[model samples]
Target: MKDAAKLFAYFFAVVIGGALLAPPLFWTAPHFSAFFAKFDFESFFHRALLICALAFLWPLLRSLRLRSFRDLQLDENRHALRDVVAGILLATVPLFVATIALIGTRIFLLKNAVPWNALGAVLAAAIVVP
Candidate 1:
């Protein structure tokens, strides 16, 4: 049950974050083609993606009772910045690329209808690769 909850949280975060970020990308693509690189969608997409990735900690949270949290110990040398950045890059790149690719393929190839989100391909790759 705990593991299931963790996975559920992860999925929810990823899906929600991706969904929310999609609009800005699509919306701004045309108006700022020349300066698309300088766009400020990061605030939205980065937050969403980080939320999604951080959802992985749900299982760790579930592992502890309220008592565990109370009794938690910390390693003095532990640093979250490196780990967080790495996770963000990993999660962001794959998801953003996969989503964009899938969306593009579906939109351009399938008669301009986004009938199937690119998540299927992303899911398949995620499953197959690992």
Candidate 2:
């Protein structure tokens, strides 16, 4: 029970702390660099939140006594990249197919021209944010 509570507290701190930190980071990023100003709010916010969450990662690992990937049972495997690619495909292929079907069936219409320039960033954020 104590371990579970500790785990829950860690998660709560990371998630809530990230949420609390994101707004200030989002607002101040442009001041630190012009590049940050160019990104739309949603993109910037997602990145900021990810950054904030990652800030807690080292501490979390330390608290769990995980000194290395092997300690966490995540030692590198030769199949790691392949497995990640397969997992991404497994998750996205169905969603892509369903989206295409919806568009074909006129259930979901593309109302605006695709913003090709922003597509990469948007895709990156979609993959990384969650």
Candidate 3:
């Protein structure tokens, strides 16, 4: 019952947080001309929110139990920056490679040349979203 209730609350939080955060995240996402013609803010935001929720859910659960930040197993060395950097790398590299491949294959639906800034923005989103 305790676990069930926690799950329910987490689910509710994800839905609500996703809805609230989606607009800003979608609005700020790098607007690149893609095969799709226009960015779908609604879909993008929802997806981003879901990804973030899944990625952070464990830490969220621990925090909810009133665990100290240090107790979260953030890192043994107590340096969280390294962990965060590692996480960003782990998340972004594959996505970056796949994005390149998709664009190269014309599967990404980019209608125009991908500008460096646009690519940078996408990379930023990729890093930040997870």
List lDDT for all candidates, in order.
0.61, 0.75, 0.70
Candidate 2 versus the native: TM-score? 0.52
After superposition, the stretches of candidate 2 with alpha carbons farther than 4 Å from their true spots are 26-48, 74-89, 108-130
Among all candidates shown, the one with the greatest TM-score: 2
> Which predicted model would earn the best lDDT?
2
Candidate 2, RMSD to the unseen true structure: 5.6
Q: What is the lDDT of candidate 1?
A: 0.61
Question: Per-prediction count of colliding residue pairs?
Answer: 0, 0, 5
Candidate 1 per-residue lDDT, tens place, 39-118, comes to: 45644465446555666455556554434644567565477888889989998999979878988887534365764778
What pairs collide in candidate 2?
A: none
Off by over 4 Å in 3: 31-37, 63-130
Better candidate by lDDT, 2 or 3: 2
lDDT over C-alpha atoms for residue 76 of model 3: 63
lDDT score, candidate 2, position 71: 81
lDDT, model 2, position 117: 93
lDDT of 3 by residue, 1-117 (tens): 476777777777787878787776666565543432255766666676776689669766674674667655654668689989999999999999999999899886765665776
TM-score per candidate: 0.29, 0.52, 0.40
lDDT for model 3: 0.70
Q: Which tens-of-lDDT digit does each residue in 1-40 have in candidate 2? A: 3667767877787667767767787788778766566666
Global lDDT for candidate 2? 0.75
